[model samples]
Target: MADAAPPLQRLKGAMDAILVADVFLVMAGAAWFGVAVLCHSQKIEAPLQLFQTLWEPLFTPAIGLLMAAALLSGLLGWWQRRGQKRAPGTGS
Candidate 1:
């Protein structure tokens, strides 16, 4: 079997994947919101209901998860920086 990647490499890959996913989620969410707003403004009940029926149930939890992931990523970066600052022989 091929050797596994180093932990740092694996972490970097995971972070990259998350960043891509975040970008996609933001873009898709914005597009969805725009369409939703347009539908509502035009009094297009059928399309609006269709969009809501397909999107609303997942939207809340997805946003919550996205926000939580972003917060966690920021906090982790902060913690890593703080740790590096405190390591011996590492000049600030």
Candidate 2:
């Protein structure tokens, strides 16, 4: 079973990377939304325009990626749990 260690470590590393990306995407989206709300409430046109210029292009794709990552992470966790349940000598 020692030979299996590297692949398992790689899988964990990949999962960690994906989770980090998911978190970053969420934070970015939240920050963008907060900026938008602040801009609207403050009636700041120049900053609003600048934010829109940068955010509009990436907003939809970023949301989509965040959602996809969330789903993938959930599925991966579920799959791991299922595998663990099925492993030999592991009781319910």
Highest lDDT, which number?
1
Checking candidate 2 for backbone clashes, the offending pairs are none
Q: For residue 50, give model 2's deviation from the true position in Å.
A: 3.3
Reference-based TM-score of each model: 0.65, 0.56
- How far off is residue 62 in model 1, in Å? 1.5
* Residue range with the least summed lDDT across 10 consecutive positions in model 2: 54-63
lDDT (tens digit, per residue) of candidate 2 on 1-92:
45656888899888779667767876877786688778889886675566667665765666677778779879989999888878875565
Give per-model CA RMSD.
3.6, 4.9
lDDT of 1 at 91: 64
The candidate maximizing TM-score is 1
Return the clash pairs for model 1, or none: none
- Steric clash count of candidate 2: 0
